[model samples]
Target: MASTKLYCFAQSGNAYKAALMLALTKSDWEPVFVDFFNGETRGDAYRATVNEMGEVPVLVEADEKLSQTGVILPYLAEQTGKFWPADAKARREVMRWIMFDNHKFTSYLATYRFLHAFAKSDPPVVAFLLARVKAAIAIVEKHLGTQPFIAGNEPTIADISMCGYLFYPKEEFGFDIAAENPNIAAWLDRIRALPGWVHPYELMPGHPLK
Candidate 1:
């Protein structure tokens, strides 16, 4: 049996963050598919047994059941000694970007994509989110131009966290993000070339939302 189990669905970018970390680190892990679209996450059984927060992307190892990609990514890095900087300063930089990702970058983009593709939220709401997403992407685009990765020269958990949602099809997002940002596109290409890289859709279960 795999030593780690990640409760996740294919379409969740947050889940992808943890899944990607496990993959890139070459951890002996397996996915426990979460039926997110069919209201599985919100169910009482899942809440009682898996996570009280009722969220996907929970990482299970022995007796530890850890939720939130912010926690999962760093835990995996610590355990595997991959995608984490050895330098104390660089580790702080990684945390900074990870916080930024959870707060601004991934938060805005994931919200916008969810409302646009799934919720079919009102245009005004979608536009509001899109504007913020663009703003966050602009910051990343500029930052990536100066360095090959988010935290520094080496690929770290920050890069994994930031690129969580970017790998999905443009149709789902209703726009081509890479086409507009050359720097981000190149950065993504670099990440793609890494060993054990896998697309989110193929990395987990519950694709097509049915």
Candidate 2:
């Protein structure tokens, strides 16, 4: 087994998507924490070396580096033969949900949570993102109403993708999703029961904010 290293920080759910996959797959991997809160991802050094996109969750194996949660999750699934779909059609279905997660589902919710809690940006901007957040959550709620997971009956990278950022505390966004969205809550509970399930804060480093 080749040595693996993940460039990540504790607070990023996007990073946790890949980190959680590593844990679930029982991969012999190590973490290289990115100082995100102190503007590390925005710096020139990180961009020049780790990832030109200046992002967290860069999975490095040998000399190759992979980023983006959608790509990273599927790559790990294929490599480990753990969470990948069984057929081409199911594979496409998984990709479809992963695309939705990257574009429609996680994007809006991540932005809303950041602006509402961490960023503390303008009120109008926060309101706009909050509207998008609700819209996205409603769609997921309706979809999960008829299914156990996002891609299919089984848990896949799609579920990992969409569930990112959602496991955060309700007070962070000043809302309780478990209280408002029962379907989503049930789905999250299902995912939580999976083997090797761990909170993002517990799995990764640089938490407790020294």
Candidate 3:
């Protein structure tokens, strides 16, 4: 099979999800970094290769192009046969959580993090963002209370899809995952210690990995 090529922006969690999966699966691929701050993604050259949405985390496989972090996770999992579940029922569960991450978690927490951490914050917007974060965390904590992993016992695409947004609170917001949700906190530590779990900020401009 031909190697896949992923085009991403270094500072983005959405992009990191694809990169992390590639590393975990031990797949051979090329990572092209797009400069979002410089409008590199909107360039004609990039648009021709990726979705017209101008988003990062675009995966190019031969002639195919894929956008959205949620879609990229399962695609990589299915291709590599690594994180995806084999059972029909299990696979559905994996998809369920991935959708949850996109519709529920990423919609709010990721937006909140991007706004508060990167852009100038508005007090009203920050308040609204924090409410969403709390709501998302409550849902996660409830789900994680019983299952060791999001999709149950072993890690799956669900975990990878949610890891970036989940980790953001602890590292950036001075919020402790352990204090907020012990189960998720432990899970966070395990993910952080994973083989290819590079922090997004570490790859940002002028920042060196510790």
Candidate 4:
């Protein structure tokens, strides 16, 4: 197998999803940190190298590159034969949840968390964003009540993709994600207990997860 490299922003949850997959798979790869704040991703050199979209979490495998975090997670998992389900039906189910996360949950909740928690945006906008987040959480809470993981009993690419976004709001924004969804909380605990599980930001001393 050819060597792989992942270029990502250290603080981004989207980027962390890719890193988490690489770690979980025990894949040998190099992680290059892109300085998003300084427009490093937008530079010509970076644009030509991996993603023209100027996004972080670009996975480079030999001569090929992948840009989106959603795509990167399953690709890595499938390559490693670890988290991805083998059955076609089960894989489709997993894809359903992953697509839902990409089109629905992440679009609203992740954006809201990003704008409100980190950007320190307008209060009115934050309030509006919070409402959307609450609605999205309600839907997830309903689904999680029945399913052990997002798609089924075992963890899959869907869980990996959604986990970081789910974690960030609770950790940084003081959002009670677990309080609203008890089942989801249980699932989160299960994933946390998995072998080789590590926080992407573990380099930060005194991280709360410790």
| lDDT, candidate 2, at 74 | 84
Model 3, 14-115: lDDT tens digits are 777787788777788877667776788778877775668878888888776889978888888878898888999999998898888888787787777767
lDDT of 2 by residue, 140-203 (tens): 8999999899977899888888888878888888899878999999999998999998988888
The ten-residue window of minimal lDDT in model 1 covers 201-210
TM values, all candidates:
0.96, 0.96, 0.87, 0.88
- Candidate order by lDDT, decreasing, is 1, 2, 4, 3
In model 4, what are the clashing residue pairs, if there are any? Answer: none
1 or 2, greater by lDDT: 1
Q: Tens digits of per-residue lDDT for model 1 on 1-210?
A: 997899998989999999998888888999999888789889999999999999978999897889988888888888889999898988999999999999999999998999999899799999999999999999999999999999878999999999999999999899999999999999999999999999999899888754
Q: Look at candidate 1 and tell me the lDDT of residue 210.
A: 42
Query: How does model 3 fare in lDDT?
Result: 0.76
Cα lDDT for residue 51, model 1? 94
Supply the global lDDT for candidate 2.
0.88
The prediction achieving the highest lDDT against the true structure is 1
Per-residue accuracy of model 4 over 34-137 as CA lDDT, tens digit each: 87767787899878866888887888987678989778887787788988888999998888877877777776776787776668778898888788777877
Sequence-dependent TM-score of model 3: 0.87
The list of candidate 1 runs beyond 4 A from truth reads: none
